[model samples]
Target chain A: MDSLGLYVLAAAVLFGVGVYGLIVSEHLMRKLFAINIMGNAIFILLVAASGPVEGAPDPVPQALVLTGIVIAVSATAFALALMVRLYQETGQATLSSRDEGDDG
Target chain B: MTAEALALIVFLPLLAACAAVAFPGRWLGWIVRIGLLPLPVLMLAPTLAVLDQNVIHLALAGHASPLGIEWRLDPLSLLMLWLNVGITVLISLHAGVSFRPDSDRGQRFWPLWLILFASMNALVLSADLFNLYVTLELVTLAAIGLIAVESKPAALRAGMRYLLLALMASLLYLLGVGLIYGQTGTLDLYLIAEQIEPGWLPVTAMALMIVGLLIKSAVFPLHAWLPAAHGNAPGPVSAILSAMVVKVSIYMIWRLWFWGAAGWDLATAANLMGLLGAAAIVYGSLAALVQDRLKMIVAYSTVAQLGYLMLLFPLASTLAFQAASYHLLSHGLAKAAMFLAAANILSSVGTDRLQRLAGVDQRRPLDVFALALGGVSILGLPPSGGFVAKWLFLEAAWHQQAWGWLVLVAAGGLLAAAYLFRVLGVICLHPRKRLNRRQHREIPNLASVAALILAVSAIAAGFFSAPVLSLISAGLPPGVTP
Candidate 1:
């Protein structure tokens, strides 16, 4: 396979790993990491999939990647803060152990 | 002039959000007012322009598509703009009461609220797929933040689950955007629609994006997070989340299916989507019937109400388009009213437990009235916006001679009626001893009045259907025959 095809395959593998981690890990922090990994995978695919324009990498995908990175980072930061707050409130960082009748 | 106005519609609330953060306390109220009050007046220019031109496209910063971002305003988008403005401004009245600007909760709530508002306006107007993803993220983040703003353990947990799912969904959507961009080399939705062939890659991309949107919109089987999140949020927050937040993703799905993928033969996939809608209507209503809490019922109703929109894909005609778009408007107003009313009831009566809410109508007549009025629309009764929309849906189905879809429409409305009447029966008909004066806390009239206005307008929407229906028909999607 060519180098571009190899990168696309790698991104796909990474995305699968991220989805696996997101499902298996109970910790909110781990889930956040999994989400970021998935985001990174998409970024790689975004940049890899677009062909070069006149021998230069496509500028639009690069710009899109940069924006995607900013969004992923901010979302991660917010998720981390939420996890901490959740831990403080419930004394548990995982969603599974919450009290069933506590919904109000 | 129209371009500047369009820009202002998005940026005004965003600017208010920044200003809200800088000056967090006493000035927040005035900031929100200044931010939102001019929106309707500003929307007039675009409204007129769309009416005259059928569709108006603005290339941001004077660069054309395939390079610069584009914003399109057609009848559907114009309707969305009006709904966002009307609902947000009215709901703000309730928020202003519940989350006082001088209070700490208000300080956090207003900024996120403004940001969500701006992002939604941008989302509806966006002509680029990547831009839609960004705006969807912004809307999701801001909305989840609002959900957890109260920091109740339940709200926080709900927010966390929603955040995780929303993040995953955005990534899926982004992957699809990447694939589409790779193939078409243009991010513009119209350009992609024009250039895309009915091939494996493009079909896969469309499937990925639609599934991502389905999750975001909380269609059946993907809607587990909705009840807790919408149920636990503060009154105004829940109102907006149910009314517009979820609807925006569905709107994106509509844009993609009818406009972006116009040329593709999606008959099988459309049937699959319709089946999901049928499932959601059945499952959501049945789940809602058993929910003990009032807010959860309303939240589940949102899940069910969203089903009507999916029917459009299968019915795929101008009538179906009109029906679905009209459903969006009516359901948005009704659902917001219901949430706001439920919030008031919960705050006043100290709980929304269906069993505990007996005789609530005696003390909080306005709120109960608002809730029932909103329920009338949800159940698609006459002289309500929902009734008009449901009639259109049935007519669309009848025209297509799709008996199963026609049955589903009828059954959905009946199921809606069943759950709605269940709530009304408990609140209005249950016998209870006279409550002690101390048992009920007095909520402000303004909160109840705000909900009443929304409910009344939902009913009012049925009266003004002709103009809106004609406008919707004026800009039908490419493949549909008007």
Candidate 2:
């Protein structure tokens, strides 16, 4: 396969994996990890696809992807904290409100 | 002066947030509150000056050719910036007084909030694609942190779920950016539009990007993370998340569709969006109707309000686009007011359940007024900006002969009204609860004032629609008549 084709396939695989993780993972933290990995995969695809403009990966998308990475991690960290809080207060990880005496 | 002012608009909060870390305990909350004061003034002054001017582009970092970042200001941006700063100030004010000095995780809240403000400013000001992505990430991170702060188990789990979804969305968006770069070899949106061919690559990139952003915007099927995350967050945090954070992703969606990939046939996409929007309107309203909790009802109401955004794609005209922007601004005001009113009721009852809020209006006249005003705005009743926005949106849809989209728009407003008044009905009914003396802490003056400002803005913005609409039309593309 051509380099572009190879990159596309890889991106597809990563996206698939991310989706799988989202579906399969029950723990909030694990789900976050899967999500971050998925994000990294996309960032790789973006940088790879924009290959070697002026003998360099295009700086603009790179900067954007970098920013995206930081955001991904920050959000992950925050969510982890929230998950821990949820576990401590309510002793559950699922999102349904039924257990808290909430109807619907 | 402009550069300094713009820089101050973004960085002052960042600096103060960082400085607040070492601040003494007794003053920590106050310090955080003080840190957010300058931004609204900074943004407000420029907005007035740029009232007639359409596009204000500021070049920064001065390195030529794709290296430097550009800050573009437009009426849409100014409105967003003002709301971000204004709402943050009010949220901070409420947080300062309502939170116990010793409670809430010390100085952390202010820093994250300031960072969120900075990122929001950057998101609105951003001129190019990369900057938009970066700013979006910043917003997501800060928002997640805010959600997790409750330190309750559910908050942690919900926050984590939100984070995961956000990460997935960001990754997907990045992948799309990569494809666009490969095809065009440029990151500047304007430059990309010039070089991009009408071909498979750009189309693929657009699809991927839309999917990613749809998740972030919490549009329909991808919106699983929002209701829980927004509902579970602290009151002020919920206000900010609902009022402005989600709108940033929607703004980026607009930037991409309108400016970057302007010529792509959006008919199918528009119809799909319209369908999902319709579903969200009905589903969100039905969901809100059944929600026993106040915040969840409001959170679902957000889903319905968000459906209004999709109307732009179907009715893609200057008028339609202007109406969408109007709805965005109006919804920001009304939703913020709604959340603040909900916060007031929660404080009064030590809970946010609707049934518990019985007799609340009778007991707290201020909260009653706030809820009533907020309800009127959300329902798109007369003299409110929500009404003006719906009127304009309906007008544009009627002009296009897009009858299906028109019906959905009207139906969404009615759904919004149904949900908004459902809670109002509870308050007005005066159910069987005696007010516990201990639960009554005087609602902070700032929260009420903040809600009032937004409520007034929602009503007053109708009068200024002509100017704002004109501002949005500046430099827009004209019809390509043969």
lDDT of 1 by residue, B368-402 (tens): 99999999998899999999999999999999899
Stretches of candidate 2 exceeding 4 Å from the true structure: A2-8, A50-104, B24-34, B48-53, B100-106, B431-442, B475-482
Report lDDT (Cα) of residue B118, candidate 1.
95
Model 2, span B1-482: residue lDDT tens: 66678878887877767766666466766566556776766775567656746667788766544678888787667777877887777666666655544555645566777778888988888887777777888888889888776565555556766777777777777777777877876777656777886688788888888888989989887888888888877777888898899988988887787678777677888788778878877888888889889988888889888988887876778778777888887788778877777777777677888777777876676766866786677778888878888888888878878888788878877887787777778777754657677777676677666666666777777777777677666635333111
Distance from true position, residue B184, model 2, in Å?
0.9
Interface DockQ of candidate 2: 0.50
Q: How does model 2 do on interface RMSD, in angstroms?
A: 3.7
Candidate 1 per-residue lDDT, tens place, A4-70, comes to: 8888999989999999999999888888888899999999898877656358777889899999999
Write down the worst ten-residue block by lDDT for model 1 chain B. B430-439
For the candidates in turn, chain A alone yields TM-scores of 0.90, 0.83
RMSD of 1: 1.2
Q: Under CAPRI classification, how is model 1 graded? A: medium
What DockQ do the predictions score, one after another?
0.70, 0.50
